[model samples]
Target: MSTEISPESAFPGPRRVFQKLNEKPLRDDLIFYFAIVAVASVLFMMLPLLTGETAEIDGLHLIWFLVAGTLIVLVQGLITGAVALLAVSLVEHFFLLFVDVHREFEQTMKSTVYALSPLILFSWAVLLKIPFAGLLFLAWFCLSTFFGVRIFHEKSKDRAVFVALATGVVLAFYLHRAVGI
Candidate 1:
């Protein structure tokens, strides 16, 4: 057997990566998870700076304001993301049980994380302040979750769509509460 790895396999496209991650065993690298959270947090922090009006502040104060704002947003985003992940995963897990998809909670959590990759990774779009930008990312998240649940849980299309909708609703609630949008 060839030991060589194909480029596509080594560095898959986004959808493939999502599929591979959901198919694999649960990742133990806390750093990877933390990095995802950190990147998302930074993007979240940038939205206000990019889109909102700021008071006229001089150099030192501006630097201090940015530093402090970043710290607070990062901390809050990390905490809120972690809690939402667990809570949503638990809810999805139980929902699967009712639908007879017999998957483990860890598997459900992995699927949820990968499904959310679109939103977390491309959140910078929101910084542009375009109308309905957030909705685009939300739709992307829902589409990813639809496929993720189908592949990871071997769910039917109807069930997958239901799970995706439920996931979106939960995530929207979290975002609404967190971002006050």
Candidate 2:
């Protein structure tokens, strides 16, 4: 489709997200918050990857590693968070700029909640499995529902699921590269 959303018709959620963080240095709030989360996650994930089974460590080295790992985790968390926010924001931005929302915002939020239910359920199910890593699409679908609803306001159905899946793939690929996966 042409997807020519007028500034007025474009979704409101994305506009709000952008407006909230677009102040003072442009992306300070987003970068800082997400960085902390990413760093923690990265460090935690890295622990299982370390080898030498029960290798002894000096007090200083252990401390340093902890600090360093924490930093990386924070970095990753922040980046990922920013990317997540950006994904939704971009969709909203486009919609608001090109399309019109005939429905109300509250309705959109409800649909998003429903659509995201599956992803959350799947993540909880696959959190520590022997594989099926690709199942993350379930979570992405769930998340995208939230955004889709926010932007489209219950106008579209499964479209949000696809959007979420696409967002997940993009995020995973970029993160793998950024973290040297």
Candidate 3:
């Protein structure tokens, strides 16, 4: 489907247009979850800051953090709100499009990802004194990827526990660098 556009797609016929849209083969259910996540992320980022964590924006460093935060929000918001409606879309874009993580774990994965990414992305933004936004995204993506894969692929609770431990290990490395933890 990624490669082969239908014959009817070349023409602007209604059927052709639908066919063309359908050709991409991304799932509708995935799109729905994506929208939900994007909205949630944007809202969370924009919401009034209630804590020193979100409330204060200090010097040039904080300014840079806010800027990167905005970009992270925008990217996440677009993907969640504009890009596609599927959980798979989130997984695809986030996981280097490595594998389709299937529908069963879609909800859990989307929830986990949308919930985690901004905070993790903003870690660099808030901790901008620490490193580039990409490093944060990289760390968060790696942790999220492991967990997302754990959510969808692990066959048993024991495997799930190990997956979580592994995620913690990777996350601890980045966070130690970020927070001196």
Candidate 4:
């Protein structure tokens, strides 16, 4: 592990989780993702109830629809978040090597998870049905990654930007195509 990338120092406390994500534990990151997904699922399930939009469906059918839909979304969100985390970490690791930056694989993974925290907000934006929200979230995600890469490759801002953009764009495209955002 790099001396500068110690988890303890990188993430000293969680009061400012978004700012100090690099130091947070991987399990904590996963938990955060899961918590966000659960919250979004609840919001989605409650939308019809809150808005009284179930006029088209019968009572039993409406109940089933909301329950099943929430489960499907919850499962999909967890799967998507996990895959994206692993993929981003792997992509950043290889890209760093290509740029001759010798960062530990675990360190890169930690940074990648931290960089992806904005994705939680992205989910909320999606739940709110905001206009062009995916694009907005993508921009935030990319900016998060830019700073993350810069952190990992301290002396090479240009290389960091290159790696961050390359991998971030690929991930964004993947999400767009798979999630149909």
Question: After TM-score superposition, what is the CA distance of residue 59 in candidate 4 from its true location, in Å?
Answer: 3.1
Clashing residue pairs for model 4: 11-23
The number of the candidate with the highest TM-score is: 1
Model 2 misplaced stretches (Cα beyond 4 Å) = 1-46, 49-56, 91-99, 102-129, 139-152, 158-181
Tell me the tens digit of each residue's lDDT in model 1 across 1-181: 9899999878877656656666466664234565788888887767666766676888999999889988998998788778867876787776677678877777787777766655666666665555676877777778877777787887998998898888787778777633235
| Per-residue C-alpha lDDT of model 2 across residues 43-72, encoded as one tens digit per residue | 454545463443367778977876776677
Candidates ranked by lDDT, best first?
Answer: 1, 4, 3, 2
Q: Global CA lDDT of candidate 3, please?
A: 0.48
User: On a 0 to 1 TM-score scale, where does candidate 1 land against the true structure?
Assistant: 0.70
Tell me the spans in candidate 3 whose CA falls farther than 4 Å from its real position.
Answer: 1-29, 49-73, 79-151, 175-181
Query: How do the residues 46-104 of candidate 3 rate in per-residue lDDT, one tens digit apiece?
Result: 55453334645678987787778767986877664443224333434343233333444
Task: Give the range of the ten consecutive residues with the poorest summed lDDT in model 2.
Answer: 18-27
Off by over 4 Å in 4: 1-19, 44-55, 124-132, 152-155, 175-181
Looking at model 3, residue 29 earns an lDDT score of 35
For residues 1-181, what per-residue lDDT tens digits would candidate 4 score against the true structure?
A: 5557877667664334434665666678667766765675566556767767655777789778877888887787678667777888888787788888766676677667666766664565665666777777777666766777676445366887788788777877777843335
- Output the TM-score of candidate 3: 0.31
Error of 1 at 179 (Å): 12
- Return whichever of 3 and 4 wins on lDDT: 4
